[model samples]
Target: MVWIPGGTFEMGSDEFEDSKPVHSVTVNGFWMDEHEVTNAQFAEFVKATGYITDAEKPLKPEDYPDVDPEKLKPGSAVFTPPTHPVSLDNPMLWWEYAYGANWKHPLGATSTIEGKDNEPVVQVSYNDAQAYASWAGKRLPTEAEWEIAARQGKPATIYYWGDSLKPKGQWPANIFQGDFPWQNTAEDGFTGVAPVKSFPPNAYGLYDMEGNVWEWCADFYRPDSYTKNAEINPKGPSSSFDPEEPGAVKRVQRGGSFLCSDQYCIRYKAGSRGKGEVSSGGNNLGFRCVKDK
Candidate 1:
């Protein structure tokens, strides 16, 4: 864990609608994981507690009453890129609900984490992340804490490293470097989620703060969250609200993921925000932990 000496910093960006009204936020010092939780770490938690992640649990028929009985099986959203270019309008083109896809089998039931213990564990829901944090005696960082830590005492810039997308002609973070939802040139030395600390750490010595995998945060997501006044240690809105999906409850997710690309999703940029339904998990999403100081 790294000690994040928190202070006031600009917490939002005007570039994105949800992150509009760039605001100042203050936070206290806290100990944050230097990298996202890895397969090894999560494996230990599961072995010790015999914990069953959300992706591995059977779906309650009552919870998904409207869905087909067969479709309610245990699984998660996996990023299955198309062989050819496809319209980015609908994410369904590249995302599929793979049955038996869980943290243990990141890609699907046949995939294994045997040689990828150091990689960040994906396919974990908000509830699963919370469970791991609790077992580790830590908690997920609040959205304010997460943004401030990612800033790393530096002034707001397009990227965490600097204003340039690729500083000094080198990939500073793991992000898509080719066409969206199709071909990935892997110009960043990674076609998917890179192992933790594979890229240069931020000024605060934190790894994968901008990409690698979208990280779960401890806050209910609201599209208009920035419009509300929360100058100090803001814990986000009291409830989740996304105008696009009003019925779905979502939590704030930060750091973006390897799938992010300039041609499509650019949420990896500093101060940008991401959100996912609390019950949903995906191959490109994971989380880190923070301890109160």
Candidate 2:
């Protein structure tokens, strides 16, 4: 395991109500994967462990009563643009929970990973990621560790690199450009996820910590928990909640995905955090590995 020497740094922010009172945090040394786990890597894990992703497993009737039995087959979420305007509050407006889509088939029923062996594996649930990490002898980074490394040794700035959204006219991160939802300039060289390590690494040699895809963390999300937390290695709230969802079973996801647009959701910022269903997976979600001494 490659060790990342730990030290003190400011965590969280005062921008959002949840991110109030930025405080110091001292992390102990822990090893972490330089980048997100990729398709090829996961393939090997599956070959060796015969591990089945959540999407591949059949859905129990009790678990998904509303889902059509036929649609319960292996699948993943694929971005589906609305033919007309949609409710921004409801993500299902633009996100289609397609059938026959998984890590192997990212774009619902037809897409395959034939040429994207190096790209970070998508459509992996928290359990799927944990399974892969366990097989690889690693673990997911705590949200604190993720935040510290994402800052890349710099003081907490809005963006990972600096305060400037577009420094010197360079699209440093892979984010949506132009009109968003309706139109993307692809000015960042990519309208969708670029392969892992496609962009320059941060000061700590970590890649894709900002844009590309939202990475999973071990912490249970607490939007307001940061307002009153300890200074050292705070582990977030005991649980999470999303009133929109049926039953609250959400987990923390950091580093906004390619779908993030300033005009829509300005969640691409370093401090901006969101939660995912604990057992969910989508085209714009992936996971990196971490280790503790």
Best-matching candidate per lDDT: 1
For all candidates, what are the clash counts?
0, 3
lDDT of 2 by residue, 91-119 (tens): 77788878888999888868899999988
Error of 2 at 16 (Å): 2.7
lDDT of each: 0.92, 0.81
List where candidate 1 sits over 4 angstroms from the true fold.
Answer: none
Give the CA lDDT, 0 to 100, for residue 38 in model 2: 91
* TM-score against truth, every candidate: 0.98, 0.93
Model 2 residue 275 CA deviation in Å: 0.8
lDDT (Cα) of model 1: 0.92
What is the Cα-based lDDT of residue 102 in candidate 1?
Answer: 97
* C-alpha RMSD by candidate, in order: 1.0, 2.0
